[model samples]
Target: MSPRILILGGGYVGMYTALRLQRKLRRGEARVTVIDADSYMTYQPFLPEAAAGNLEPRHVVVPLRRVLNRCTLLSGWATAIDVAGRTVDFSPHRGESRKIEYDVLIVAPGSVSRTLPIPGLAECGIGFKTVEEAIHLRNHVLAQLELAASTTDQAVRREALTFVFVGAGFAGVEALAELEDMAHDALRYYPELKADELRWYLIEATDRILPEVGPEMGRWTLEQLRARGIDVRLGTKLESAKDGRIVLDDGTEFDAATLVWTAGVKPHPIVRHSDLPIDAKGRVKATSRLTVEGVDGVFAAGDCAAVPDLTNPGEYTAPNAQHAVRQTKVLADNVLAHLRGGKMGDYRHAYAGSVASLGLHKGVAQIYGRRLRGPLAWFVHRTYHLSRVPTVNRKVRVLIDWTLALFFRREIVALGALSEPRREFELATRDK
Candidate 1:
């Protein structure tokens, strides 16, 4: 009988692994089954651009069924993995729980936003992890502008216009920068609102921002943002966010309708529930060869796996798209080699560097120890990511989006009603 290969999650690792296996595996060699909550794999690096209306949201996500046509795509949640029994417990979108047996298992559910116990954070703050979140945030930001423009109360207008973002990582920085640019561009249409009135604050617990781009670039980014009148409070932490009131450890207090949290990410919670051996950080313990440590016929990579950094012996590779995308190639190759009784190679790629877009025509990059900033870095950021974002179909679509953007003004219209399409219907049906 052919081996049944079960893959958990359809994000960067899981989707790429399945894609590679489908192409490389001989007919009847293995049955690849990929299970994920969503049927589409989001190219998360393009999320900020999508939110800023630079790229269509649909283009940023690859349909699993479309891409992994050869693999059995299961739209469900992997509740538990009994590694000892070689069976996984899964629950579909609307069905009874089922157990699936597999000869080879790959766990790559990826990471979730790492949040802290700050007061009222769960209710008050929003995360920047998914495409849905990105779209909602964009709509919410634009809606806030509308609210500020038409509101008569000074406090209400002030609260509506103030946007606060926590964390200085890529997600937080990029999202904040892009959204701010979009909002700034939008101000030309709002005769009642001024650009200066649209207050933007960036709160980072650390002293620096965009640490991936080196200290010099980080400092330069800080200066650039400051020059644009963005309030960047470094070495600050959010003490509380109760009732939409942002209280920082630095003694700053503000009532803002918007708060974006992109502090960091932890290994997906499924990792802890699984029978796989996990490191102290709650990530699957992975060998340098991309196989789970102390386990046979099992592999792990991406954010969910603590893959040892061969270049830096005491540390694991940083959880980022750069490493995740590269690791997938090695992971797929190793999995195939293992199945065929061939020698598996170690996953070793020295940290190439990082690229980050600060907004339209603004960015920073550090590649191969060389640093770049401004429009050149921004171009480099787009070019590098454009090459990396999976599929020729998406690459062409994204290029067209960019090409069209050159001559077109940004579409700033907010569609807040999309989230509550039934609200009007329900209200109309009710007795007035």
Candidate 2:
């Protein structure tokens, strides 16, 4: 029987591994199967552009079936993994739960939004991880302007136009900057809605934002955001968000219809269901080679695995797309080496500098020991991510979007109905 290689989660690691295996291994050598909850691989870096109306939402995600044509694609979620038995249990989109035995396993379930027990968060706030959220935010931001324009009441206008973001990392800063740019531009269409009337607040518990980009870049980012009339509150945390009323730990309070939570992400809880060894943070204990500790034929990578950072002592790799993509290459090569009776190689990558976009045509970056700010850094930010976005088709589409944005205005249509597909059904089924 051919070796059955099962990869869980179709994120960076899963998709790259399956693609590499399909290319490296000859036909009938191994049966590769990839399972994921979603049918698309989201290029997360482009999410801010998608939210800001700079790029189309559909272009930010690649359909898995179209990309991974060689492998068996299962659109489902893996519920449990029995490492000892070499089998995986998953719940498909339809039908009964099923189990599939595998000769080798790759666990890369990735991460989810790490939320807190703060009041009204789950009921009121939105996460900024998925493509759906980006699209929804784009529409919602535009819709807020519409609401502000239609309402004569000052309080109603204030509430509708207020936007709050929690966390100052890349996700929060970029998202806030992009949306603020979009909202400011969108106000031109609404005579009643002034750019100054829209309240934009960025709350962070830490003293600085964009820690990955270092202190100097972070300070520059703060100044840039403040210059744009953003209320950037550092060393402050969100205490509560009940009924869209935000309460900061510093005793500041305000009502905002738009609250985005981009604080951080935690490992997928599905890692706990597996018998594989896990670290204190609940991530799979993986060696430098990306193999599960004490478990042969099982490998792990991406956000779900605690793969050691060889360059840094007493530290594992940080969960970022930069490391994830680089690690995927090593993991793929090692997986191929293992199959061909060749020696597996270790994963060792030096930390690369970080860059961030502060709205369109504005950016900060420190790369290869060189510091850059303003348009140069912003151009570098776009150039680097565009290069990394994957596939020639997507690259061309994204480039075209960028080229068109130079001459044309951004589209700021809010389709809030995208969030709730069964809104009418829910309303009709409601008890009167």
Candidate 3:
């Protein structure tokens, strides 16, 4: 009988591994099955643009069934992994629990939003992860302007116009810049809303933002943000956010309806529940080749696994898309080698710098030991990401969006009803 291979969480690692195995391994060698909560793999780097109406939300995600045709695709969430019994317990899209036995397992369940205990955050704030959140934020930001313009109440207008973004990382910085640009362009249509009326504040507990791009580039980014009238509050923390009142640790207080939390991410909670060896940071501990330590016939990778960074001594790789994509190639190769009884190579790659977009026609980038800023950097950022955006079909669509954006104004329509799909249903039911 052929050994059954079960790969969990169809993110970068899971999908790539399955695809490679399907191509490398023979039909009777191993039967590969991949399971994920969602059938689509979100290309997260494009999320800020997607949120800013620069790109379509559907284009940012790749359908798993279309890509992984050779492997068996299961739409569900893995609840538990019984390594001892070689069985995984999972819950389907809308069904009861089911268990599947596997001779080999790959646990690559990715990270989730690492929320803090800040007051009212759970109820008020929205995170900048996934396609749903990006679409919701895009609609919400546009709708805020509409609400402010239609209302005559001063307090309501002030509350609706103010926007707060927490965290100074790539997500926070890109999201704030893109949304700010969108809102500014949208205000030309609203006579009552002025650029000054919209308060854009970015709070970061750290002293500097964009640490990935080095200090010089980070400093330049700070200046660009400030020049745009954005309040870049460094070394400040969000102490509380209750009833739309935001309190900073530095004793600043403000009332804002939209609070976006792009603060870091933690390993998915499902990893903790599994009987796998985990690191101090709650990540699955894997060898340099991406195989789970002390677990036979099991491997892991991506944001959820602490794969050793062979290039950097005494440190595991940082969780980022750049590293994830590069690591996935090695992970796939190593998994196939292990199955074929060939020698597996260790994963190692040097840091290749970072790039970040600050709204339209502006960006900061550090690549191959060179620093670039302004329009050149923005162009480089777009060019680099466009080339690396996975499939050729998505690349063409994104390039077309960019081409069209050059000739026309951004789409400012806000479909806020998307967040509450059941609102119309509830209204219709009540009317009946």
Q: Identify the leading candidate in terms of TM-score.
A: 1
* Local accuracy of candidate 2 as per-residue lDDT tens digits, 103-213: 989998899999999999999999999998998888888888898899888888899989999999999999999999888888778877667888899999989999998
- My TM-score estimates for the predictions, one after another, are 0.99, 0.97, 0.98
Write the candidate numbers in order of decreasing TM-score.
1, 3, 2
Candidate 1 positional error at 391, Å:
1.1
Model 1 spans with C-alpha error above 4 angstroms: none
- Steric collisions counted per model: 0, 1, 0
**Model 1 global lDDT (CA atoms, 0 to 1):** 0.93
Q: lDDT tens string, model 3, 185-281?
A: 8988998878999999999999999999999999999999999999999999999999999999999998999999998999988888889999999
Q: Which pairs of residues have clashing backbones in candidate 2?
A: 139-414
Judging by lDDT against the true structure, name the best candidate.
1
Q: State the displacement of the C-alpha of residue 67, model 3, in Å, after optimal TM-score superposition.
A: 0.6
lDDT of 2 at 168: 92
> Between prediction 2 and prediction 3, which has the larger lDDT?
2
